[model samples]
Target chain A: MPNPRLFSLKSDSIPRATIQRLALYVQVLEDLQREGADVISSESLAKACDVNPSQIRKDLAYFGKFGVRGVGYYIQDLIASLKRCLGIDHTWKTVLVGVGNLGRALLNHKEFKLRGFEVIGAFDCDPFKIGEEVSGLEVMCTKRLMEKSHELGVEIGIITTPPERAQRAANHLVEAGIKGILNFAPARITVPEHVVLEYVDFFHHLYSVAFNITLSQQK
Target chain B: MPNPRLFSLKSDSIPRATIQRLALYVQVLEDLQREGADVISSESLAKACDVNPSQIRKDLAYFGKFGVRGVGYYIQDLIASLKRCLGIDHTWKTVLVGVGNLGRALLNHKEFKLRGFEVIGAFDCDPFKIGEEVSGLEVMCTKRLMEKSHELGVEIGIITTPPERAQRAANHLVEAGIKGILNFAPARITVPEHVVLEYVDFFHHLYSVAFNITLSQQK
Candidate 1:
C-alpha cells in the first residue's frame, strides 16, 4: 500500500536533488549499519557518500533534526527516519515483467527485500521461460499480467523486457493499476502523469563516469 | 587512449550536474538520431528527458553553443559534441569481473558497445564459468584479470561480482592500470583518489521510484 502521508508535505519545497541525495544518504547509512556502526558523524557520512558534510546536514534538516550535538546521529534512528521519509519503511508489493538475464538478476538480487520491495510476481512473453522458477517465483506469461497483478495487489511494476516489448509491458502494468514503474528496458515508454517512473539506464552511469574520468585526467 | 583535449578547455567551470544532464541529452539525442530526426528543439528534448527546457539550455551552454536561434539544435551536431564532451567518441576497452546473472546481462547488453564501451575481457572466480564464452569474449578466471586487462589495454573496469568480491575486483582492476570503474556490486568499494568510481545500484532506482510513487499517491 502507498504511504498515506507521502505527498502530504509540499513537494514544491523539496528540491528533486534533495530527494536524490536523501536516497544516497540512506544507502550510505544502510552500509554503515551493516558494518556495525552505531553512530556516525555527518562529516564521515558525507565522506562515505562523496558529498560535502554540509549537504548531508541540510538534506536531513528538511526532514527535521535527528543528529545529536556531539555524538553524531544514531545509526538505527537515522535509518528508520530515512526509510519512513523515503516511504520504504513498509513492504511494497512488486511485480517483475520480462525474465531475461537482467530480469533474472533483479529477481535474484537480495537487496530489494532488505529495502521492502518484494517481487510477488514474475512475467515474461517467452513461452520457454513461462512456468520456470526464478528466485522462488514461477514465471508467468505476459498475458496474465493484468489478471494476476490485480489479484496479488502488485503496487510496483518492474519492466525488464527488450526495447521492442517494453511498451507492452508498461501498458499491462498501467492497466493493472501499478503505481510505480522501474524500467530497465532501453526503450523509453510513456506512463500516465500520475504514475511514477524511473529509468535505470546503465549507459547513463557509464557516460557519467566516462566524462568524470576525462575531466579528472585534465587536472 | 584518454581524450587529451577533454580538459584543455576549462573543467572547473562546468558543474557535475551539467555533466549528468549532458549524458541525458546524449541519450535522448541518440534515440532521436535512431528515429531519423535531424534536428530537435530544446522544448521537445526537455519533454522527452523530463527536465525543464531552461535547464536543458543551461546545460548545453556549458559546452559551447550548438543551437540555432530559431531551428533548435541540429541532432547530429549535438550528438557529435556530446560524444566528444563526454569522451565517448573513442572506444573504451573495458573488462568485466563476475559471470553471474548481472554480469551476463551486462555482457549481453549491446548499448555499451554502441556508446563506445567495448567489453574486451571478462573475469570470474568460478571455475565452471572461467572458460565459457559470453557475447564473443572468453570469460577468464579472476586470477588472470591483471594479465588480461594489461594485454587488452582495458581502461574501464566493470565489477559485477558479489558484494564480498567487489573490492577484490576493484583492487585487481586498479593494479592492472584501469583509470575508471563501473561497479554493479552492492558493496561500496573505495579506490585511490585518482581512480574514477561510479556505482550502479539498482536498489537506488527502486527506492527512488517507490518514494516517488508514494508521494504521487499522497498528492
Candidate 2:
C-alpha cells in the first residue's frame, strides 16, 4: 500500500520539476517491469533515465522513501506508488475535440488507454465527420459536447484541432466543464485559472533538437 | 540581421532552460507579429507567455541584448534573432520513418514547413503502405531510408512507429545519417552522443494534468 502521507502532501509543496521527473521515473520503471526486472538499483535506473542517481533519490524522497539500503527499489512497489502519486491509478474520463488527421491518430493511440485516460467521447465541428466512426467512437457534433461531457462526467479534454480553431475548441471544452486540457495544436489557447492546460508542441521539441544539433556542430 | 556572436557562443554556456524559454518566446513573438503588432512591452509579452518579464529579459540576454530602454522589443527583429539563435533560420531537411496515423498527421502538419522543417522522405516497413500518397509525399519502404536520406541530405528523423518497432525504426534512422530525431512513439530509444533525441510523450503531460486536478480537488 502507498504511504498515506504521500496523498496527504500538499501539491503546492511539490516542485513542478520533481513531478515531471517522477512521471518520467514511472515510465522507466514500467519498461523495466515489462522486461521482467523485479528490482533495480538507483544507479541502473538513473542510467536508464539519463539522470543522476542522487536526483532520482531526491525525487522519490519527496513523497516517501522506498529503496532499501544496498538492495535498491522493488519495481512493482515503485510503479504502484508513483502511479498513485501521479493520480493515474484510477481511470480519468476524457473527451477529445476535433477529428482531423491528428485527432484520429490520438483516438487510435494505445498508450492513452494503457495509461488510464479513457477517451469516452469524440467531438468535431465538421459536418462531414459528424457521423463518422473513429476508433470505436462515433464522431458527434461539437454541440453535444456539453451535454455528453456532463452526462459522462468527463474530467479531461484533448484538443487536436488546427491552429485557427484551437482557441474555440478550448472554449467549448471549458464550457463543457472539463477540469484539464491537453492541447496538441500549434496555437496557444487560454483556459481558466481553475483549469489546468498543457501543450504537446512538436515544434518546441523540434526547435530544441535544431538548437542542439547546431550546438554539436559548433563543437 | 542577427549578431554573428549569437552563433559563435558555445551552446554549453547557455542553460537548457534558457533554450526552451527562447523557443517559447519565438512562438509568442510569431503570434504577436501575425496580429500586426510591431512593438510589445515586456509586461504584455510576459503576460501572454505567463512568464515574468525579468525572466524573458534574462533569457534574451543570454544570446545578446536587444530590448531598448522603456520601448520593449520590436516583434519582427526579436522573432528573427530568436529563430536564428535557435538554429531554425534556414530549412532543415527531415524524414519520417513511420507512415502510421501519427506519422501521416505529422506529414500533413503545415507548421513543420512553415517553421523551416521540410520533410524530404517518408519511409515505412508496411508492405501495404509503401508507395501510398501521404500529404504529397509517397511512402517508401524502410529499406530505402538510408539511400534516400543520404541522397537527399536528411538531417532530422521522426519516429512514430509502435513501441515494439520504435527501436528498429530509430536504428534505421541513425543508419540513415540523421543528426536529430523527434520520436512520437511512446517508447525510449538511445542514440549516439553526436545525435540529439527528444520524446513527445503525451502521457507525461496527461499525468501532470491528472496530478494537478487531483491536487485541486484536495484544495
Candidate 3:
C-alpha cells in the first residue's frame, strides 16, 4: 500500500526527465556559486551546461517563476530555491546497502558528501565487513538496517546489493519508512505505493551507448 | 571543424533522459517479444516498465509513429523499428580504453555480449594488464588503439580511464573514426564536431540520487 501522503505535496505533472535536469542545473549553479557568479541569465546557464536557453527556462518554469525578465536570476537564491524544490535543502540521512566494489567507491566519492547527503550507515551480509569502517562510514549488519534506519528517520535509501538481494533490500527500505529509493542493483524491482523508486541499470545504459553509437555512425 | 554531416545529424533537443527511457522501452519490447506477446499498447508497455503511458507515446513520436489506433503495436515489428532507430541493427565492434576496475567490471559484464555489442578490444597503459585476458576479451596496449581501431573501424569507444586520461582516450576515439563515445571518466572530455559524446557520470548520478532523495522527502 502506498502512503497516499508521500507524494501529495509535489507537482504530479512534472515530467521526471525535467526533475532530473533540475538536479543537473542545480549542480551547475552550485559550481557557479563557488566561482562567485552573482547573476546568471538563462542563456548563460544554458551555454555553460550545453543546454538550450529555452529548455532551461521551461524546466525552471515547471516549479514557479524564478527568473526576472530583465535581470535574470540571483545565483544564490536560485540555487537555494532549486535545492528546496529538488528536496536537497536539508541534510538527509541514508544507508547504503551493498558495500561492494562500486558501493565502496561511491562512499569515498566527495560529490555525495558535498551534496548534503551522508552515507551514515552501510550494510553487507559478509561477516568480515560488519563493524568495519569504510570511507569513514560505519558498516553495519544487513539485519540491522531496519532498526538503524527507523531510528535515524531515514526517508531515503540506496540499494546496491547484488541482483539476487536487490528485492529484499528494497523491501527493507520500504519497511524502514524510506519514501524515496535509489536502487543501483542490476535487477528490476516492484515497490508498494507511497514510495518513489528510481532504477539505474548499468548494463542497460552501456548497451544504449553501444546502440546509439552504432546509429550515429550509420548516419 | 565538425564534420558538417555529423553536425547536422546531432539534435540536442531530445533530452538524454528521454533517450534513456527509449532504450528501456526497447528492452521491454524485446522481453515482450521473447515472452511471445503478440501486440502491446502504450499503456501495456508503460505498465510493464512502471512509467506513464502518454510518455511512451510522446517519446516514440520523436522518431516516428508505431502505435495502432486500437490494435496496439506489433511486438517484433516495433522491436525491429527501435533497433533501427537506436543504430543497433548490426553488431557494432567497440573498444574499451583505460582498463581500470570499472572497465574490467564492464568488460566482464555479460550484458554487452547479450546486447549484440562486443568489447572486441581493450586498451590500457598499465603494462601488467596488456596482453592479459579478462572477461573473455583480450587486453591490448593503449598506444595501439588508433591503429587497431582503424583496422576494425571501431564505431563505439568506452572510456573508463581515470579523469586524467579521459581526454586522451576521447581524442583517440575521434581520430580513429569513432563517431560515438561513452565516457566513464569524471572529467568532461571535448570531442571534435563530428563526434557524439555521452557522459556516463557514475559519480554524478550517484550524487543526484542521494541528494534528490533527501530533497524529495522534504516539506
Name the best candidate (by DockQ): 1
lDDT by residue for model 3 over A112-147, one digit each (tens)? Answer: 656767678888888998888988877888888788
Q: Which stretches in model 3 have alpha-carbon errors above 4 Å? A: A1-12, A33-41, A64-74, A126-140, A202-219, B1-18, B33-42, B61-74, B125-133, B137-141, B202-219
What fnat does each of the candidate structures reach? 0.76, 0.72, 0.20
What DockQ values do the models have? Answer: 0.75, 0.61, 0.26
Using lDDT as the measure, name the better of candidate 1 and candidate 3: 1
State candidate 2's TM-score: 0.95
Tell me the tens digit of each residue's lDDT in model 2 across A1-219: 112233766325776667878888999999999889999999999999988999998888767777889999999999998998889888899999999999999999877878888999999999999999999999999989999999999999999888899999999999999999999888888989999998878788898888888877766
TM-scores for the candidates: 0.96, 0.95, 0.81
TM-score ranking from best candidate downward: 1, 2, 3
Q: Residues B1-219, candidate 2: write the lDDT tens digits.
A: 222334655325776667777888898898889889999999999999888999898888767788888898999998998988899998899999899889999998887878879998999999999999999999999999999988998999999899889999999999888999999888889888888998888788889898888877777
- Per-candidate iRMSD: 1.4, 2.9, 5.4
Q: Give the runs in model 2 whose Cα sits over 4 Å from its true position.
A: A1-6, A10-13, B1-6, B10-13
Candidate 1 lDDT tens digits, A156-175: 99999999999999999999
Docking category of candidate 1: medium
Clashing pairs in 1: none
lDDT of 3 by residue, B14-130 (tens): 556666777788777877777789898778888987789988888777677787898888988887776666656667687999877667767766667666677789999899999
